[model samples]
Target chain A: MKKPEPVGAVKHRRDTVLSAIVSQIPYIRFLGVSFDRHGDELTATMAYHPDLIGNPMLPALHGGATASFLEITAIVGLTWASLWEDMEAGNIDVGTVQQGALLLPKTIDFTVDYLRAGLPRDAYARAVLNRSGRRYASVHVEGWQDNRQRLFAQATGHFLMPPRDAKH
Target chain B: MEDLADGMAVISMPYDEALIGDPVTKVIHGGAVSALMDTAGGAAVMAHPRAGVGTATLDLRIDYMRSATPGQRITATATCYHVTRSVAFVRATACDEDGDLPVATATGAFTVIPGKSKT
Candidate 1:
């Protein structure tokens, strides 16, 4: 009978997968973005940096930074969602993907709603997958600081899904 | 903002690895392009001939047409198409080395500073 994989190996694989996913996205690293994962769900964080400011007169975070943060959240969140089922079935093994990095969805359109001025502070966001099909997907991301209920900005993005048959 | 005139503005960002979205393709992220377009739109609104003071983005929609070439600076131009008592509308586009082909196009609404003159 085949034996179950040990817990340590499973944890190592998970860590490797996560690192490979993030490190491969240079923009996310450049923006100092990080993620906290719970199963298939992800919450992204961007710590405030001086370079993040666009209008220093108002001392507000650059709208672009906020927008980028939200979009990356959605993309990475979707990537995780795609991987969850395989991981659950014990099919996710690190160093197997010939694609080198996690396959990032291509953005077709993104609409951002700037609700409030982004203050100079750490920001948090979460992405909700509105719908995903074989060739198209939509995601909504909301960003906030200090309070989760009061969002500083939100975005709805539609993406073109990569071919599923393309080996992972 | 490199240049600003009546109802128009232009901005550009040089290519940097830090802004790259696709590690494999080395293409800049749509977010970076979004930020550029938003800033350009706001600049256009603030520079409008309608006695603008300050402005805030209410909503901005961007449609990406193609991936930007790696290591090419991106430039965006925005035109304030219309204005009202409390809002301004802007249309903008971004492009890279292939200046004729736009990387993305955007339309946005921005809040206009209150108190307009009768003239």
Candidate 2:
């Protein structure tokens, strides 16, 4: 009988998947944002900086920062889901994937609801995928801080999937 | 932001490598454009003749009409189209060098600050 892959190997592959995809995007890094992976899902985190404050009186985070975070979380979630399939089927070379082979999904449209001012503090967001079809995908993302149940902002996003064969 | 008059505002962002979304094409990320529009929308609402003390985004919807031309500055223009007792409605568009063709368009509703006015 053939033995299954070792846990360490699986962990290494998981790490590779995230690093390869996340490292290539400069905006994510420029915003000081990061993702924590759980299985195939990703939760994005952005640290608070005085530079992010928009309203001096309320000291709230800029709406642009909130929008970027939500949209980025949705894109990363959609991209990772697509690649996980290839990785599982053993169709992807980890080395090739790391060589800037990943393509960021295009935003077709996005809607954001600002429930409350984003307090000047660290924030967290999770993308709940609605659909991940080959041609298009949609995601609903929620952002919160301190209390997960209390969302400061939420968004619904639609994305155009990248062509797999690079012919498009 | 500038030209905040008659319930309208304009804001612009120059091309920045850090704002690029697609590493291959070098197109700026749509999120950056969204932010520009959002700020412009807020400025428009505050500049409205019936303006308020402060405004916050209630909801915003954005459509990406096309990819922004890389290495070009993008400008957003917002107009506060309507205002109610508690809400202000705004529409905004972002364009690069190609002014005729918009890179994105947005419509949003913002809270109408009570007891505030431009006059």
Candidate 3:
């Protein structure tokens, strides 16, 4: 029997880059962000606990949680995309690269549209790469809670490429 | 009715491991700082002479300086900058036992729900 073909190499590289990024954000480690990749997109899920509650009467998931969730997703998505770019360019120093070099494109503006209220339960977010270019990248992220959609936050992030003479 | 001259009300809570972002490292989460800011902002509005007015956060921006350690008592002080016919602007900061450096700084905008008296 022929050996099964190896899974897509890009995905394997993406996961490695993502795990590195998550490890840097200690808060994310506490929040328990789990990452899963699908083709070019990535999804992250975080479980909410009682300590994150802002309003006891309403039991609303604090907006800060929502903000952190969005920020993490953006960072992860950009890191994943940069990994692919580095691979295509035959650069192996991606691990030591700074965020500015990896995000080559800058996010000029973004918005988050809260669709529904979140409960003290698990929250999910998915980041989709809308466009990736040399100077900028756009990503759309949506968050869900208790199986209901809660937020739609997008980032138009810019990443600065390495300066000429810098070894990559 | 609580007097307006009392200045913005202050509330503080002891930091705990749960507030720490890393269970093992004991670094407080930035979100926790933001939450404390939000709570302080709301309490400042509620402490105003006007009671029964609901306040919802419109926008909040926080600048993080350093992370708080677990088991440190965090004191939050909120000051109401202005209260218009419908909007209230507030600023707050969080400090630990040392009180020399701020862990986080935040500013927020709140809108008073309809049919509520300022007093």
Over A73-146, each residue of candidate 3 has an lDDT whose tens digit, in order, gives 76566656666656545475546643323322222333334344457777778766776655456666778765
Instruction: Please report, as a residue range, the 10-residue window in candidate 1 chain B with the lowest summed lDDT.
Output: B110-119
- C-alpha TM-scores of all predictions: 0.92, 0.96, 0.62
Q: Report the lDDT tens digits of candidate 1 across residue range B1-119.
A: 67999889999999999898987789999999999998998888878878456778889999999999999999999998989888898999999989988999999998887875333
Q: What are the per-residue Cα lDDT tens digits for candidate 1 across A1-168?
A: 979888777666666676678778889998999987664567899999999987777888887889899999988887777776786677766675434645678999999999999999999999999998878999999999999999999999999987776627
Cα deviation at A90, candidate 1, in Å, is: 3.2
When summed lDDT is taken over every stretch of 10 residues in candidate 2 chain B, the lowest stretch is B110-119
Candidate 1 residue runs with Cα over 4 Å from true position: A1-11, A96-99, B115-119
RMSD of each: 2.5, 1.5, 6.7
TM-score of chain B of each: 0.94, 0.95, 0.85
Best by TM-score: 2
Q: Which ten residues in a row have the lowest lDDT in candidate 3 chain A?
A: A100-109
Q: What does DockQ come to for candidate 3?
A: 0.16
* Pairs that collide, model 1: none
Better structure of 2 and 3 per TM-score:
2
